[model samples]
Target: MVEDGHFWTETNWVFIEVETDEGVVGVGEANWTVFRARTVVQALEDMERFAVGLNPFDVETLRQRMYNGNHFLHTPGVVQSMVIGAIEMACWDIMGKVTGQPVYNLLGGKVNDRIRSYTYMHYKWMPPEPPEKAAEAARHYVDKGFTAVKLDPVRPKEGPRNPRIDELEYAEAAVAAVREEVGNEADILIGTHGQLYTHSARRLAARLEPYDPLWFEEPVPPENFGELREVVDSTSIPVSTGERLLTVHQMAQAVENGVRIIQPNVGLTGLLEARKMAGIAQAHYAQVAPWMYAGPIAGAASVHLCAAIPNYLLQESLEGWNGFHNDILEDGLEWDNGDLIPPEKPGLGVEFDRSVLESYAGEYRPESS
Candidate 1:
C-alpha cells in the first residue's frame, strides 16, 4: 500500500504485482475499501497460496480457486472479490505481456478506439455550497471539453433514510443551476451514493427530471434489489447501479430487476467477471459504464474493458486523469478533449514508474526486503 495525500483524504493505494518464472511482472490495483487498505493487503496475502502455481492464461480457474477454493470464507463480499480481482487483473497483464498483445485484444478486440469519460465536480463545490457555486464548477469541466459531469447534491447527514424537504429542494436547485450553466452542451449525472430510501430516491429523481440528467446513480442503497426496482419504477430518469455489487450474480439481479445501466468497477470485479457482467447487461439491452475511484492501474484496466465492450456507455475519470495519476504511470493515460485513448502497447499498456511508486510506498510493502 502507498500513502498519497493528493486526493480529498490521505488515501492508500493497494496494488498487486505478479511475476512469472519467465521474469514477466504484471501489476494490478485493489484499493477498494474506503479506509481499510491494510486489511485488503492481509487478505491478498492469505489468498496468495491459491495463485502461486497457477498459469496466467487460466484466469477463470484462478478466480474459481480463490473464490470457491476457500470453503471457510467463500461468501463473496467486496474484500474477497477485490483480492481475486486484483490477482486476476495481474494474470491478464501477464498473459498480454507473454503474447505481445494488449489486454483488450485478448478479451475480444476493440469495439471503441476512444472511450468517452466524465468526472465529478470539484470538491470545493460539494453540497452546502450554493447553487451558483455548483454552476461555476459545472462550467469548469464543460469548458475543459467534458461532455458529462456528476454530482451528489443530496447528502444524508446521518445513515441511509428518507431525505428531508430542504435536502430535496437543494438537490433540485443544484441540478438546475448546473443545467443552466452548461446548457445542452453536457449531460448532468446525479449520484446519490446509495444514501437514500426508495421513496426519497424517487422524490429526488422527480425533482431532477426537468433538468434531464443522463442517469440517477445508486439512488438507494445497493443491498435491496426490490427497493432498487421501486426507485427505477418511480423515476423517468434511467437508474444505474453496481459499483458496490461484488459479483456477476448481483449485477445480473440488478439488471434483471430494471436497471438499464450497469456501472461495474473493474478494480473490484476483475476484468473477466466485468466482461461477463457486460455480456449480461447486453443481453438485457443495458449499458456498461465501468466505475472508477481508485488509482490509475484500475483505470487502465477499465479503459481496456471499455474498449472491448459493445454496450459501453461512459467511463468515470478523476479530473481527466491528471495529478498523481500521471506521475505514477510511465505514460499516463492519454486524455484528449473528453475521451481517453486506449494505449496500443502490450499488457495494460502502462507501467508504474518505480521511483514514484517507491516514494509513495507506505506500511504494507509485502515484497520489500
Candidate 2:
C-alpha cells in the first residue's frame, strides 16, 4: 500500500499479489479510503484460508467461497467488496496468463480496439472563484487530445446539505466558463461527489443544464435510489452514478430507477462482477463507464472489462496515466492521443516494478498466531 498525496484525504492504494506454485503471479488493487489500507490488508489476510489452494481458473467458485463463506460478514459494502474484488481480480489475471491471452479475451473478446477515457481537472485548478481557471484546466486536457474532462465544481466541505445560492452560482459560472472555452470541441462531465441533498442536486442540475455537460455524476448521496431517480427525472443532462455502489443488485436498483449510465469501480466490483454489472445495464439499454480512482492495477482491470462489454461508454483516467502510475507499472498503460490501447500481452497486460512497489509498501503485521 502507498500513501496517496494527490488528494486531501489520508488515503492509501492497496494492491494484491496472488502468486501460484508454478511461478505465475497476478496483481489487483482494492479501493482505498482514509486510513483503510491496513483494514483491507487485514480482511485479505482473513480471507486467505478461503482463497489459498483454490484453482485460480475457477473464478466464480472462488468468488462464491470468499463472498458466501463469510456469511454475515459478506454484506455488500466497501471493505468486503474491496477484499473480494482484489482477490477475484488477481485470479482473472492468473487465468489470463495461464491461457496466454489478455483478460479481455478471457471475459469474451474485445469489442473496442481502443478505449476512450476522461480525466478530472485537478481540484486546485477548479477554484469556485474566477471560473476561468476551470476553463484553463479543461483546455489543457483538450489540447492534450482528451475529448472529455470531469470536475466537481461545488465541493462544499460539509454536505449531504444543500449548497447556498452563491455557491450554486459559482458552479454555474464554472461550467459556463468551461463550455465557453471548450465549445463543442470536447465534452464536460460534472462530478458532485454526492455532497448535496436531492433538492439541491436538482437545483444545481437546473443551473448546469444550459451548459450541456456530458453527464451529472452522483448529485446526491448514493444511499437512496428514490432520490437519485428524482434527480434523474429532474435533469435534461444525463445522470450518471454507481461509483459508490458495491454490488450488481445495487446497480440494478439504479438502472431500474432510470439511470442510463452506470459507473462501477472494478477495484471494488472485480472484473467478473463488473462484467456482470455491465450485462445488467446492457439489458436496460444503459452504458457502463468503469470508475478509476484507485491504482493502475484496478485501472487495467477496468480497461479489460470495458474492452469486452458491448455497452461500454468510457473509462475514467488519472491525468493520462502518468506520474507515479508510470513509475510503478512496467510500461504503463499505452495512451495515444486520448484513447488507451488495449494490451495484447497476457494477463492484465501490466506489471509492477518490484523496486518501486517495495519503496511504497507499508509494513503489514499479521495477528498473533
- Where does model 1 exceed 4 Å of error? 1-6, 365-369
TM-score of 1: 0.96
Question: Cα lDDT for residue 153, model 1?
Answer: 92
Tens-place lDDT per residue, model 2, 1-369, is 123423332467888889999989998888664567777888888888888999899888888887788668667668988988999999899999999999999999999999999988863375555899889989988999899999888955666988889899998999999999999989999998888999999999999999999899988889999999999999999999999898888999999999999999898887888888999999999998889887888889999998999999888988767768777877788988899999999999999988987887777665631
Q: Count the backbone clashes (under 3 Å) in each candidate.
A: 0, 0
TM-score of each: 0.96, 0.95
lDDT per residue for candidate 1 within 1-369, as digits (tens), equals: 122424442456788899999899999899576677877988999889999988999999998898899677677887898898899999989999999999999999999998999988854478888999999989988888899999989864654778779988998998999999999999999998888878888888888999999999998889999989998888799999999998899999999999999999999999999999999999999999989887899999999999999999999988768878778888989999999999999999999998998898777664662
* lDDT (CA) per prediction: 0.89, 0.86
Q: Supply candidate 1's per-residue lDDT for 44.
A: 91
lDDT of 1 at 53: 83
Please report, as a residue range, the 10-residue window in candidate 1 with the lowest summed lDDT: 1-10
RMSD from true fold, candidate 1: 2.8
Error of 2 at 148 (Å): 0.3
Candidate number with greatest lDDT: 1
